[model samples]
Target: MNFDEQTVLVTGAGRGLGTSIARAFAHQGARVVVNYRASAVSAEQLAAEIGGLAVQADITVAEEMDALFTAAEQHFGTTVTTVVNNALADFSFNGDARSKADSISWEQFDAQFQGTVRGALTTTQRALPGMRTAGFGRIINVGTNLFQNPVVPYHDYTASKAALLSLTRTLAADLGVDGITVNMVSGGLLRTTDASAATPEAVFDLIAASTPLQRVVTPAEFADALLFFASPWSRSVTGQNLVVDGGLVKD
Candidate 1:
């Protein structure tokens, strides 16, 4: 997709899937804003490599998120027309380390909600006015298939993503009048992202065998689905979740 006329803000884009998403947008000609919370070095490197602006902001903090948007506009001389909410709480995808419901605490769930749900809320609010004024916008929330098939019982992570999906639909309904579309791209067990680096090779083999395509999805492959949501072809599509997991879970 050609994003020559658009500016994109990708959260948690210092590495992992965020890195792939940022690079994809830049490759497509978008003035990209790479937002990172703590991965400053990596984020800056990726931004420099892609010719994007590397901005640091903790998505859970409204003030910081606002600053990120401000920085994006100043650097690109244009409002961010697209946002990819890809920032994830620091996590190690080790199924063995995950807390089962019996051992999980509310604090764990709260942390996930703050990062996954509230963060999206804050960024959407900041970007709304600009989108409304321009009558064009695209909000793509990253999600996962764990909610559909909690194979590993990652209750906290799955719950947060489920909440994000709720916001995606509701926001789409409320923002469509302004030509802003809200959608989600859900994937399952990305091959080797920072968060998923701990996943055992056996788990990957298991998931790959279960999917019709017989392979775990890649971050770049998942990013294309997000781009479609922002592209003109999906102008009329909103409040929908597109699963891009090599057909692991059909919805």
Candidate 2:
């Protein structure tokens, strides 16, 4: 389907990478729904700037997620045809602060699971009916390259994202028959996002030096990959994880 005809919902879109993703879709002429668990002020500003809608909803909660979709449909007068599972629990990319393999707790793992896997699950389930009815849909889950590289070995975060990738492929397999496509966009340490803001300057330099592109990937760059998945150009490209880390992890 054309982007102009699609209603795109981006979770956690009030700030950070979600903000960039929302703007990118809006620039493409899509009716964007900026979903945020918090950051209402920033979200509302973004929505106004793009002439889109801003709705608050915690993606892990089914009831709130349902409301989110309902609000989008009511405002746009069309069901959401694209979903970007970009919301994550509060997290920082500071290697020194992360729990090591021997010290990580199950609670930490569970928390990440709730945000990463469960959030995606709820959003996907809620969006399926509309997508099936339209005979076209795009489900793009934001992931991390750490699953393949494990540069910092963020055990909890990496593990949960790995599971998200698994879910991405499995959903693509199951939903393909219904004319819905599911995929993932995995990125390395982004230049400047809320999650990556905790990263020290040296770490960013180190990552930039390691990648073939010789620079850290920007949130805008990562978000552009998401557009491909939602656009007709990628109709046949489902169940794949496109790594946008400038050749940092060539999987």
Structural similarity to truth (TM-score) of each candidate: 0.98, 0.99
| lDDT at position 44, candidate 2 | 98
Model 2 RMSD in angstroms = 0.6
Off by over 4 Å in 1: none
Query: What's model 1's overall lDDT?
Result: 0.90
Total clashing pairs in model 2: 0
Looking at model 2, residue 193 earns an lDDT score of: 98
What tens digits encode model 2's per-residue C-alpha lDDT throughout 1-251?
99999999999999999999999999999999999987999999999999999999999999998998999999999999999999989899999899987888999999999999999999999999999999999999999999899999999999999999999999999999999999999999998999989999999999999989899999999999899999999999999999999999976
Q: Candidate 1 at 32: error in angstroms?
A: 0.3
lDDT of 1 at 233: 89
Which candidate leads in TM-score? Answer: 2
Q: On residues 1-251, what C-alpha lDDT tens digit does candidate 1 reach at each position?
A: 24888899999999899999998888888889999988999999999899999998999888997888888888888888999999998777899889987889999999999989988898889999888878899999999998998879898999999999999999999999888999999999998899999999999999999999999999998887788887878988999999999998877
Worst 10 residues of 1 by lDDT: 1-10
